[model samples]
Target: MAVAVAVAALTLVPLAYVLVSVVAVGPAEAARLLWRPRVGELLRNTVGLTVAGCVASAVIGTGAAWLVERTTLPGRRLWTMLMAAPLAVPAFVNSYGWVSVTSAVEGFAGAVLITTLSYFPLVYLPVAAVLRGMDPAFEDMSRALGNGPWRTFFRVVLPQLRPAVLGGTMLVGLHLLAEFGALQSLRFPTFTTAIYDQFESTFNGPAATMLAGVLVLSCLLLLVAELRFVGRARVARVGAGVARAAVPHPLGSALPVTVLGMAALAVLALGVPLGSLAYWLVVGSSTAFPLGMLAAATATSIGLGAAGAVATCVLAVPVAWLSLRRPGLVSRVLERSTYIAGSLPGVVVALSLVTLSIAYLPTVYQTTALLVAAYAVLFMPRAMVSLRSALAQVPPEFDDTARVLGARPAGVLWRVTLPLVVRGLGAGAALVFLAVVTELTATLLLAPIGTTTLATEFWSNTYGLAYGAAAPYALLMIVISAPAAYLLTRESRRTVPGR
Candidate 1:
């Protein structure tokens, strides 16, 4: 209970600080700011880009997942790897890569393109997992009834895919709402960039807080809508039976077209960014690889990532256990509260913490503790989802058996549950670590003075048009993130029996 309280307090402090500071400005002042033309314009752009990006990602991601998992596409294994690989490229890096290739890629179109490319993998990964696990009986039955392939897919398969598709779409929407790097790079005005500008240029805490308040409100509305759209359906299977494998749909005459389209998307999304990185590395001078800065940034990134991952997993455990095991309104609300914080832009979370620290916790202001708190808030949901899935796999009968054998609840958990879910916990930690390592907006606002992580170092060099200097940091980030990505992929594969 003390551990849970401490975790909640740490998570809530930054949030409370932001809300209290923003509301302190009075309703009238906040209302007046909301009525401004600039605010309206920013709101419009933010909403527009979010909608556009989410729609594009859903279409592309779902299509890719379907093709690779269900269709007779050439190089299915290679395609699956390529589809998920974009996650390794940071949105900012992809933005810069696109802009480097063509001047035209620097506005609304570019914002949508970069964000879609960077985020589609979120949708693809989960949807593909679901497709792999789905019982193909429904589709087979539809086909046996003389329905065409398209009709069978839409009527039989699409309905069952709702949970995975909606889950992926929610992730994409939340990400788009909080997106900063790609939108900023594309010269698009969004609440995140505006809040960031206020902090960087004028150091106006009140203004930034006000913007964050609005962003949070928007996220709340989206969350409610997502819950409704996703429904309360469970995707897990019931009973014991051997589920037959899905028969791959034959491409027939459309094979050439299908292969060509997939190849083009792979080239645009994966090939382009990787090629750009390689190009910069080759053309850039040898001096760009500064051993000292690289070493420092690498050490800082690993330490912060490890700390944040462990902290987030610890914080998430109580909430996940409560929601999954306890199961009630309070637990549900607590679980949802973390998602709200997670969905808000990273800058908002950072700025809120900054304001709170200055006003109330002055000593901890700008400290590594505050920075880690920010990471925990932003990435806790990643830990929760992985942990929840892992916990579900451990049967309640195991605990019952242990209790019958003279073990207490704590002993049962420690002796049995903990060992069973350690891999899941590790998977969750890996996700949080990867997210923290690549995080930019929150780190920019909250990192300790004179402490530069690889993300910050890369952003600093890239913003100054020193691509050469940025290359090494970007490469290091990619290297650090690669192992986590592999772990996630491996765990995902293991989720499918006999994979």
Candidate 2:
């Protein structure tokens, strides 16, 4: 509990900074700053993009999962891999690809389309995992009651998928709220992009923090909506009956159409970015690869990503364990608090860390440790969510039995608990590593002097419209992220048919 509280305190630093900054600005001044036509315009753009993106991603992701997991689609295995390959490509990199290809993919429509393609995998993976493991008895019962196939799915299967769907959509919404690179490149003016502009263009801390304050409120609203929709209902198996393999629904005449649709999704999500990278390498006049610089940046990105992933997951274990084992108000609040930092834009989190470090700990300012701490603050929720799910599946009886055998607390954790939850740890670490590898705003602001990460390098080249020079960094990021994405795919294939 003490460890969890400390972790929560660390995670809450960014929120505290926002509140303190807003208070320092005084209420009237804050109101005056926020009450403007510009703020209203930004609010409209941010809210519209978030809502539309989440809905579109949910629809596409859920539909794709159902097709791959439940129907007799051709090449289910291949489709599973292709659906998740988008995660290997960052949203910003994906936008870079689209922009390089055509100018038409800009503004609100383009933002929605690009983000949905990038993030729908967030929804698809979890929903597919649920679909793979879910017992089909509920469907059988619904069918016996005379419901048609679609009706049975809506009334029976969809309800069971609520937790996974809600979890996924909430992630998409929060990600959209904090998205910076893709939105900026796509010419969309959202809160994140506006906040970055305010800070960079004017160096006005109060104005930027005030914008962040509003963004935090939006994050709170999203959390509330997700919580209310999720409720406290349990969605697990009730008895000890082992789940049987789900029978795939035959597509018959629709098989070819389903295959074509999957192919189209793959083309949009994976092909565009890759093809654009190859094109830029061949034809862009400014395209040049400096091997020495590229090697240094790759090493730095991997080093930082690995360090940040380790630190974040280590901090997450206690919080996740407490929340599951205690199941009380304090634990719940601590766990939920971690998500607030993650929902904030990377600029907000980075600025907060910068302020605290400069004022309170000058020695640590502009250091690798500070940067790693920032990564933990921004991405701890990813680890927490994965750890909590993993810990939930582990029976407490195992711990008790170990204790009865004369094992100490540390012994049980290291000897028994760790082995059982190792996969969860890996999954959480991989998720954090992937985020850190692609993180741009935070790395740009917080990284130590002389440290250049792949994300920062990619952003610099792309910002100058040197697509050819940027292509290599973007491609390396995708390559580095591929192993993590594959691990996630392998982890989700628990009950996939024919596996």
User: Model 1 over residues 390-437: C-alpha lDDT tens digits?
Assistant: 665455666678999999867887797777777778878987888898
Q: Pick by lDDT: which candidate is best?
A: 2
Candidate 2 off by > 4 Å: 238-241, 394-418, 495-499
lDDT of 2 at 209: 88
What are the Cα lDDT values of the candidates?
0.78, 0.87
Q: Which pairs clash in model 1?
A: none
- Count clashing pairs, candidate 2: 0
User: Candidate 1 — worst ten consecutive residues by lDDT sum?
Assistant: 490-499
lDDT of 2 by residue, 1-499 (tens): 8998999999999999999999999989999999999999999999999999999999999999999999989788888899989998999999999999998999999999999999998888878877987889889889999999999999989977776787788888888999999999999998899889988898888888888999889888887787678665545453565678788999999888888888999999999989999999889888888999999999999999999999999999888887776788898889888889887899889888988999999999999999999999998877876676567556677778999999997788789877777776887888889999999999999998899988999999999999999988998999999999888787667642211
TM-score of every model versus the real structure:
0.90, 0.95
